[model samples]
Target: MPEAAPAPGAPPHPVAGQEPGGPRVLLPHLRGFAGRLIAVMVLSLVTVVGALAQPLVIRMVVDALADSEPIKGLVAALVALVLGVAAVNAVRDFWLQRVAEGAVRAVRTRLTAHLLRLPVAEYDLRRSGDLLSRVSADTTLLRNVLTTGVFDLVTGAVTVLGAAVVMALLDPLLLAAAGLGLGLGMLCSLIAARWIRPLSERAQARLGEMTSEVERAVSAARTIRAAGAEERESRAIADRARLAYEAGVRVARVRAAVSPLSMLGTQGAFLLVLGVGGARVASGAIGVGDLIAFVLYVFYLVSPLTQAVNAYVQVQTGLGAASRIGEILAIPAEDLHGRGPAPDRAVRTPANGAAAEGADGAPAAVEFDAVSFDYGAGPVLDEVSFTAPHGGVTAIVGPSGAGKSTLLALVERFYDPRSGTIRADGVDVTELSRSQLRSKLAYVEQEAPVLAGTIRDNLLLATPDATREELLAVLDTVNLRGLAERTSKGLDAEVGDAGVRLSGGERQRLALARALLTDAPILLLDEPTSQLDANNEAALRDAIAAVSRQRTLLVVAHRLSTVADADQILVLDSGRVVGQGRHHDLARENAAYHELAARQLLVT
Candidate 1:
């Protein structure tokens, strides 16, 4: 049979708990704090020792009082032991909490780095809110695992064992009866915990889905309101919230079963110890002081035993979250260096090389040789070839879905062609690192999405070291100088999340200004004039003409007027380059170009 496909929304790589040896996902985070953990263990041992000594001290006081001896010194010793144990526990708990916080910090840092470095394809397959949930909610679960789960398991076990040993030595028969009650309770708790982990995993997954719904609603709030979809959006979010609640209730039900069983066992053990010890003491088989000490020892086991059972359940829950976190970390990041065998001619071509030549003997800025791409369903770009020459304007004009923006994407190396090669400065792009290729070109996306930050912050994204004069000049070039003039803060003015505070036209202009700030030899703009008015479009055209004098500009435009004076125009139709030449020639001779021009009344 053919191999099965992975579920939707699953990572490309397998996550922890999906395979053998997956539990080690949390090991790296804990490994660095081994020394601190040892210190906690040592302090816990001290607390156990102090606790064991208390029951014996109480027995001595009881014997002295029965013999009519002074008991003040025994009482004082008991009080001092209690105080010392409390102090040691305080120190141990604080240290553990600090270590837990550090571990969580390390996990968050690593997760953030990994998520940011993931390939664009990965982001396309996953939701942003789900990924954020992993970084926030999933990592928080680990703190309880470290502080309460692992620590309690160790310290609680030691305390329970010490008490059991002391009780057995005092009277073997009573000890046997006490063991039955405690063991049954722990067994019931262990069984209940078996069901909690899986339920917790489902709960976490449901919560992530709910988060995705909220993110979608908020980010598209304007559209939702415009379409009169507020009620529909609210219903969608409510459905996700209800599913998450159901999952949480399932986990809570299993957890609830454990507490009562644990309490019953501990209480049963106490009653058994009382009845049997009373008989032994009256018959003179055991002394009154010894019976009292044995009873005290059983009481000592209560707290730790309860802690141990609860910790076991918590450990299971943490494991569930860990599995989700490990999935993202397991996927290999986009290779910074080129993948596959290195190119035979990895070095740059000389200016005289034919491959480097373009119009007027100048080197080409970007070249596509029979390049093609697909989005897994069908090809987006066929065997297409084009050249964006140095110091020239190469405008890509086509109907919607004709792969105009894709051509620019190929130049920036965002997605590699399934066949053929793309070259920048005569070196194949696959031969150079992504950072190296991207450094040579600046890109403004089609939507021109702006981040939530000040105007200065968004502008500095392209060129952090750009001076104040350079910023002002670029803003003026794109006709966005009015934005700074209107606000008293100038560049310090805030652009709300996704640039909500600015008009669509202003956001487009700001994006262009930011791209212009870069000193890259090539600029890629996808529909930069899509949102601009007639006046703004004319101003932007002038700015593009000025920039093209020194750097190559590859613009994807639907407005025929924008590219009317281009040095070269490539008309794409159904992923194929149907026409290429000066705009006037294509408008008169090319069928696809002529039809598009006629529709816009530009063929006259």
Candidate 2:
């Protein structure tokens, strides 16, 4: 049985050193796009130059018109300046979009690689949907931070400052009058923007929860329908959606406030500039042409201010997403380089108080000494010990929740034992690099999950370079050859999602065949024949017997017939090894083994 998940409302397992800084988490990812940013900056400069020159040309045209002189040259210059700025703006937008997309791709690649390498324990605590959200939705949020957030903030600031300088040179009095309304409008927008960060954080977190709920419902759609609980599940999912909607509404409320406040300030400043400049014109302090040019510069300043405000808000939302993404990235992966037990450390005997040795008294292929484990709730395995010696089948039989599967999990090092030591061939399991250790054993899970792909794809998962002959050989070994033969594409036939197109028995055999293709000396099978019929079960037993001739096999079997001919059988009850011996010997001599055999009607 699988370990139970944490109870509802339990605190999430904390990842050490994973605190995320706002927006800054993306800085390292942006390093590769420095060239693109430089190009954007150059374009922005050209835009600023064009903007400054356009108003000057307009002023020249106005003055020439008042003088009644031919103004064709000035009009042409103004038109040229307008077209040039528009062309530069278009190019600037293209480069910024590329930079945004490239940055998002790099981030997603890094996130995917890191999530795959995370320890199995991490998956237990985190939902697949939540992790996927960080990769897809969260990384998408980061895209806007690059395009509209950071770059816009930078370019807008430069443009705003440039316009301000020109406005001050044009007329200090008019500049001062414009600053008043703009400052008030900016103050209102900044206050509104402050609420965006916290609201965005809440919104993204709620979305993650909603995504996890959706994934759970979809994956278990069959189960829900069989239980006639479709409406119940739908209602549960709707509840999650409603919470997400409420959170999003809150974020939208704040974002909506920002836009209107920014607009109000900009329009107020524009009006103030027009009023003041007109008064200056009337006083003869400035000509009508000067008033018109100053009014245009005021608009230029206002445009950047508006963009800067909007960008600030987007940056806040991106940072909110960064916090979620960082949480996953901050987790410490399984220590693949751990240095285990010193050479001088004494190796303890198996908990059975007898050495697990072969004919020559050499150490077993795999041995456990007083190992115990708990899954945060309570003990799943308690001081259990066993051995799978070289070149034979060692079967583990037990009632449900007897920690039958936990033993294989330990050997695989998916989770470390809470106490005691496990060794493979006299070397501490922890001492070997995870890659080196896993390469030594091939494991078939109980559910025998088959990924969505072709038969050829699934077969080549572990041994990617296995030739066609080798693939055919393993399929024949596990009696899965007929599956490929029935398909029109042979080995390339699609298995559909999780091998849904195949029968339960075929999925299990395919999983076994995949494991069998590996040259690993130890094969760990978890209820490999659980879904097989009587005939398929017997054939699988024969396959196991044949493979045992060359490699040690640890089979976790529920059916007594599956392991009736095993060299040794370990009977577990309540996480303790209650019996051990050949199946017939244990059935006759061990009380716990006898009860289990009688229950299965294997003994009279």
Candidate 3:
């Protein structure tokens, strides 16, 4: 497997005690900020108390006016109550915003760190863009819902309860008439939430697809344009966007039910209150001011009722996004038994000329023991065993599908073999944590990728502690000193995205320099010279030859000339090694090796 950025939407493992996509998975993130949550709740209580007081102040004013006694004092109290409501609500909103932002930041940070720790096999099953969307856009929904949905859900309930108590105090018959009808509509809206939930989740997923399409298209823009496939790619992305749009439309259609239901309940309450309260007034059962307050209380239900309905819808939307994020969290991480670093006894400090100890204390760098593996589709490595000699160059050459790269992946521990053990020194790679095992090797991938940063940043990616002189030495080794001289900021010069500013050969050499700078004893190079021209190739071969004298080098090469003089050559075909020996010896003894060398005129 190739090194990849974090991926999205692989079939995730289930969260504990929850069906795979259930909203219960959201509890951990919500629980993380208990303090901020408490603060928000306290502020909400203040807001609700202040809001509930306004209705009673109106009642006091209306009763005072009816009695023709001290209207001015009651009016002043009403003004004070209204200002208090505004003040408390403003404070509540501020706290809710802070809590929402903090929660999402922590979640995003944890998700990103977890992604880096995942086994490489996970990357094979997920699309990078989709994973990025989950981290970015999908997580944003969680924050919004946390603020709008969770907050509203809490405050709305308090407002409803306080309003209910006041309404009962104003007039029981009027309250009964309004309450029953309003409760029925709100209950029905919540029932519709079940239908709306999946649609909201699907909309987020489809949007992830759009993000995936866009990322692929952008990354391969030059290839698409060169091949004149822009229209085809654009159409594909547009189609995904269309599906996302349709999914969003369905969510909207479901959510639209909330407003009309709230409106229906509001209208229903107004009619019931007007008719019942007017009857009470005409019957001289209650004062006109009392009837007005009863109607006012009935209208008060509309504001919080609408907020509650809207908040519930937002919660459903949030759960939809949470389901996607949960899948990522649910997937088992690729930790080595969740253990810490290798014991101090097993630690191999890298000196200038280090060689890992094999079983029986034999001098070997890496050993693959009876390794057999497949990538779900079919077998890629079959009963393969090889030992990379310490302080020497061993080259693996094979046809396109012969599992040469797969062998390198196993050594890197990207995926473990099904029926074998890979050892760094005498210890099984599985016995060490991922960080521990990777510490022993420096791997350069076939397509030599550079990250978005300055030239110096890319150089020091693996071995951050290397001195400036050491950095200059590796750059010079790869014949990239001229690059340092040419750039305006020298090592500090920006490389642009993936080092696009550098030529193909420069990228490959820079990647090689990064690997060389590492203290790792084993160097694994996968077609590192694939992009180089004759001049750079010769320089790299010399560099490789010089490096191997001090460190173990295992290289996978397709082009025969690059590895023609390797100390040992392993020739593979159809997932099995058919030959292994010095280059000239293999050419004479093995038919497959002979044919490969003959094609390259290496044995003609």
Measured by TM-score, the strongest candidate is 2
| TM-score quality measure for candidate 3 | 0.93
Residue 207 local lDDT, model 2:
87
In model 1, pairs of residues that clash are none
| Clashing pairs for predicted structure model 2, backbone only | none
The residue-level lDDT of candidate 2 at 513 comes to 97
| Cα lDDT listed for each candidate | 0.85, 0.86, 0.80
lDDT of 3: 0.80
Tell me each candidate's TM-score.
Answer: 0.93, 0.95, 0.93
The digit string of per-residue lDDT tens for model 1 on 513-569 reads 999999998999999999999999999999999999999999888898998988999
Which lDDT tens digits does candidate 2 get at residues 1-604? 4566532222245432246545666777779989988898999899988987888889888999899989988887888889999999999999989988988898899889989888777787788888887889989999989888988899888888888888898899989988888989989998999888778878887888889989998888778999999999889889988999999999999888988888888888888888888888889999998889988888888888888898999998998888787777777666666756423334455557644676778888998888877776887888887778899899999889998998898798887777778888867787798888998999999999899999999999999999999999999998888988996899999998989899999999999999999999999999999999988888888999999999999999989889999999999888889899998899899998898899999997
Q: Which tens-of-lDDT digit does each residue in 495-591 have in candidate 3?
A: 8898888999999999999999998889999999999999999999999999999998999998888988788999888888889899889889999
State the local distance difference test value for candidate 1. 0.85
Considering every candidate listed, which one attains the maximal lDDT?
A: 2
Candidate 1 vs candidate 3: which has greater lDDT?
Answer: 1
The better candidate by TM-score, 2 or 3, is 2
